[model samples]
Target: MITFGFITIHPNQENTYITEIARHSDSNTIVYRFIPTAIDPATEKVHGEKFNHESGVWETAVFDIPMYLYDRCFYGDDPLSIRSQPIMNWLKNRPYSTFIGLGLPNKWEIYNVLRSDEELAAYTPKTIKASSVPKIINKLIKDKKLLLKPKNGSQGKGIIGLMVTKGKVEALTHKNQKLITKSFLSKSEFSKWLDQLLSSRDYMCQQLLPLQDVDNHPFDIRILLQKNENGEWIEQGRGIRRGLKDHLISNINAGAEVLKYDDWVNALPVQQQALLTDGITTIINKVPKLLEREFLNLFELGIDIGFGIDGGVWILDINSKPGRKVILHSKEGKADELYKAPLQYSAYLEKQSLVKGVD
Candidate 1:
């Protein structure tokens, strides 16, 4: 018998999509779930329930297995929601226990992996941390327009763009509103804003890359890569997400919609198509390799790339555990195949157990 534990950030009610995937697996094996339930853990064993779809009931079953370990497998953002600290410790001490997408690489590590100025062209916007405010201000003067962002931000939450010329700076909120040049005109006001933002969390200043859009809505591509049993990276899914029109960020959580990347790429001018594919391929290959070298345990990554207005490609961001919502949307509910990577990998790991048993 094999022991597998499926967990997530939210409860099963909010994550029906993930539950459906687990329910569809082969029935020859016993699957234990650690989701929160009304049953008592001290009296009722945790690993004895079987899901019944007709009544939406999970009933306890009889089973005794020698292997005692859990796989923190999940499809949602909160995979480590229940007793994570204890679960992590248990997996570390037990033999043959492993986790996927546990913790992601930091922002600085990602930037060092896929930043290519020549390939990015106008899309390779200059960026700096709030700690380097002095240096960033100098660059803002030269570039005339700059974007400020939070260090650990996602979904375009905390970003501000500033326009500058001849020591005069104009501020624009996330909505891209034009100011009257009075409240945020001088360097002192800029310093004040920087101080407040920095006091809470670190921030970065970047040159505004003119990202391409569909129907005036800026869009970015998220390429899903996975390593098979042979340990080769294969492109599993690709889709473009159109952000709320004129917004500084293109994250779907912040009012964005998913589209097919091929649809947009095929419509581009012929002369630029080759350059786009080559650039995307180069980043897709090298970025993952760099992360592998730096963060060896990271097996899967979601690389976000977008095109500048002039057809130049730029790496917008890299998410270690990006939600599968967009990928699910791309396949139009035909995602059972792509969603099987974790299960297939689990089977491969089980083979190791079988080989050792035979020996």
Candidate 2:
């Protein structure tokens, strides 16, 4: 039998999703879930939970590390995240273990690679590391507005929008799912605030794009791409994610709403619809191939594309460890396929390994 593992920082994280994946797993496969910190380096055993298919419950167990692993760990600045980093690095370097998808690097590194691609350059936004407070302040003054994002952030967290107008500066960000806006009467005050924020963590700054709808709600097109059992990349689904009116981000975790892609596109003018379709198709075709070539092998990607008010298309973000909320909300009857994806791909990888005489 083939053993497949799912690793996360918390035991309860993604419980439902992992359970569904286990339930849909094939007869030859068994699923286990573990926190990366639970692995005993001395014994090469992991103290974790195993899914009992018949009872549909996860039970405590200790076993050897699985041959194939699906890494779902999302790290933050917390202590637990700090401790697990070196352990995960150790696991990644283990010769006996194989990850379903070797994840991508930070946002700054990804942005540089994407901008260098000739075909993707037009869609890519110009980004700079927020390493200098004075430089960021100058850029904000010159551009009139800037968007700040954590270099390693996900789920739309740690994003701030800054706008300068008539000697006053305004900043907007989300905190605990609520929009918070603050105004500074002088550039000096805004500079101090920017300095403090940039010091807290690494960040990237970009010229703010008008990625809002007619009603002023920020929105983006989220497309999910995954590799099939044949090891070929395929479009799993696409949907529209719209944030609250005047919000800076359209991440679902930030309380955004999902809209069916077809419905949203059909509401636009015929010419505009064609333009968007072509643009989306081009990105869907080029991004995955380019990323795999530049980085490592990847099993899936969640590509976020933004359409500006000026009819410009922009690639806002690309995530390797993507969430399925947009697809589950926008597309019907995809639950089974989504659940089976990991298992099917794992089986394919196992087959390829055996063909190469790998144990």
Candidate 3:
């Protein structure tokens, strides 16, 4: 029987999704979940949780690292994350094991790649490393608005909106699910605040896009794409994520509301709908292929797309280890498919490896 492993930073992380995946595994395959730190380097065994099919529960067990791995580790500035980085690197380099997706680089690196593609360049935003506080302040002064995003951030964390209004620089961010606004009277004060923010982590600056809805709430289209059993990329689902009024981000974690994709699109005028469809089609068709060509093979992608007030389509973010909340909310009856996807893909990989005599 083939073995599949789900690796996360914490044992409880993504418990629901992991449970569902294990429940869906066929008799020919087994599912296990573990943290990188759980591996015993000397013994080459992992002391982790294994799913018991009969009882439908996860039990503590010790076993060798699974041949196929699903990496769900999200790192932060925490010590655990720092320690796990090297362990994950070691696992990735192991000849006997493989990750379902190798994952993508930081946001700035991804931006540099997408912008270089002629077709993707038009949709890519102008981004620069937040290396100079003075330069960022100058741009905010000139353009009146800019967005500061952590280079490695996800779930709409560490995003700040900077705007110069009425002779004051205002910084807007969400904290504890509440909107927090702070104003600076002088460029020196604003620059000092920005410097402090940048000191903790790397950041990127981009000219703010008009991604707000008619109600002035920020919104974006989130599309989930995954490779099927045949190892071909396909769109699994898409949805509209609407943020709180006057917010900087539309992440679900930041109190965003999920809307059905068809509900949003069908309400638009026929001509506008046609245009939007064509634009979305062009992006979904080209992005997966382009990214795989530029980087390593990936199993899935969560693409965040935005439509500016100027009627321009833009690529907001691309996540290799994507969450399924948007898909589950948007598409009814997709629970089974989503749960079984990893297992099916793992089976395919096992077949390929057997044919090539890798194992």
Candidate 1 structure quality by residue, lDDT tens digits, 1-359: 44544543334533454455456556544444554332243543444445554555656654332132223333222434444545444544546445543445456545544454344333344556657667777877787877777666565666777777555676656534222232366688787776766677767767877785656667888888876655467777888888776666677766778887777779888877887888788878777666676665554678888787787788777776666767777756547765556556556667766789999
Q: Mark the regions of model 3 whose C-alpha exceeds 4 Å error after superposition.
A: none
| Candidate 2 collision pairs | none
Error of 3 at 325 (Å): 1.0
- Where is the poorest 10-residue window by lDDT in model 1? 63-72
What digit string (tens of lDDT, one per residue) describes model 3 on residues 218-333? 99999999999999998999999999999989999999999999999999888778777877898899898998998888999999999887778899999999999999999999
Q: What alpha-carbon RMSD in Å does predicted model 3 have with respect to the real structure? A: 1.2
Better of 1 and 3 by lDDT: 3
List the candidate 1 regions with Cα displacement exceeding 4 Å: 32-96, 115-126, 165-183, 214-216, 353-359
**In model 1, what lDDT does residue 258 have?**
86
TM-score of 2: 0.98
* TM-score of candidate 1 relative to the true fold: 0.76
lDDT (Cα, tens digit) per residue for candidate 2, span 1-359: 99999999987899899999999997799899999999998898999999998898999999999989999999987988999989999999999989999999999889988898897888998889889989998898799999999998899998999998767889999987689989999767878888898888999999999999989999999999999999999999999999988899999888899999999989888888877888888889999999999999999999999998887889999999999999999999999999999889999998999889965
lDDT score of residue 230 within candidate 1? 51
